[model samples]
Target: MAEDPGTALVDQAVGYALLAMAGLRADALARATPCRGWDLGTLCAHLAESLVILRETVTGTPAVRACRPGRDPVAACRTEALRLARAWPAGGDGARPLAAVAATEVAVHGWDIARSLGACRPMPDGLAERLLRAAPALVGGGRAGLFAPPVAWPPDAPPGERLLALLGRRPG
Candidate 1:
């Protein structure tokens, strides 16, 4: 079956994230990240679990597995991301939206992972821009606990950075 374009886009973003995560060392898993109280391992765990839940939502399936710490966090994420990208239903009202959110999560968390490692790789601008436009509704105007209050960014800031700000991440 042909993949949905949104799903494919999400897959691409996940691929980039997996690449970034592949370089992380075991010791680095305990390092703090931009996600407030979350360390690298915590962020990774969230990312993986979120993907699985979103996948189940999109696929109309009961979640059968729980995310747990793995020997290789990167590999665990890669596996879950692949499952999410592949498991999107052939047709569903929520599939595209779920795919988009999954894409945003992976893309934004990709930045979080990179930030924790002090890596300077850029988030995909197109995906960030798309998510930024959809985010207000998706996240209920940055609801409490889901996201921090939106940080102010200059109008002329880079699209990806601006998107990050909209999602409550301070872009450096």
Candidate 2:
């Protein structure tokens, strides 16, 4: 079967998120993250939930049973990420748009995880460029509670920085 671009994008996003999660320790779970008011643990939990949603969207199967409270957030995210990757390639025709949204969510939140760890990891330039093009439609308007107002960014900024700014993150 021909490789699906959407599946590839989701794979890349999950891989990047996993890299950001490397070396995370329980002691640092309380660290503040770029997502205002959310600590690292909370952000990891949200990431795990997002992964489950993405997997369910593609697989049409409930995966939320893995998200019990007190489960290690990173482990939960890893499990769901693996499941999502496995399901995405077989996600049928309706999964493309969902793939784009999932890719964006995972990649941006991956950046957030890195930032929380005081790292400056940049999203892959190609992935950032693709997501930047798709972001306006994905996050345009009605974003009051879900996202902060868009941060102003120079037109000439790198794609990763521009994408982050569009999603209301201040890219350093």
Candidate 3:
């Protein structure tokens, strides 16, 4: 059977995140990331935590216990991503919304990881477009702690750049 669009989005986002994490070295964990005040290690830890939460939500199982990303964050993220992929349900209305949110979280944080490494990896065009379409709904009126104020971008900018700007990241 074909994969659900939502699930596909999550998968793609996870792929993007994993790719961004490919170059991460243990020595670089202390490097600063775009997400103000968060270091690379902290960001990776957050990503791992987010994936576990997404997995639990999708599987409808309460987490047995808190998950700690441990010493090797990259491995932790990979493990969590695998778990999420395996736990993702075949299809359900409830999964779509969670998927959208998960995709956005993973993709944006992936970008953050890349930027932290001084890489200019653009978010894939298709994924960025989809996330942009879902942004307003996912980030309704209150832009308090979750995100910074939206940054302005040229109308002709790439979808990835536009999406990054909308999410308050200064894309280059």
Best by lDDT: 2
Off by over 4 Å in 3: 64-70
Model 1: per-residue Cα lDDT over 1-172, one tens digit each: 7766776667777876776676677688899988999998878778877887887777778774445534466656677877876776655556777767787888888888988898887776776677778777777854788887789999788778887888788987
The global Cα lDDT (0 to 1) of model 2 is: 0.85
Q: How much RMSD separates candidate 1 from the native structure?
A: 2.3
What is candidate 3's lDDT per residue for 1-172, written digit by digit as tens? 8888887888889899888878888789899988889998888888888888888888878763224534577677777876776677768778988888988988999899899998889999999999989999988998898887889899899999998888888998
Give me the runs in candidate 1 sitting further than 4 Å from their true place. Answer: 1-3, 63-66, 69-72, 90-93
Clashing pairs in 1: none
Q: Count the backbone clashes (under 3 Å) in each candidate.
A: 0, 0, 0
lDDT of 2 by residue, 1-172 (tens): 7778898889999899888878677788899998999998888888888888778878788766555877988788777777788788554678988888999988998899889898889999999998988888888777888887889999999999999998889988
The estimated TM-scores of all candidates read: 0.87, 0.94, 0.93
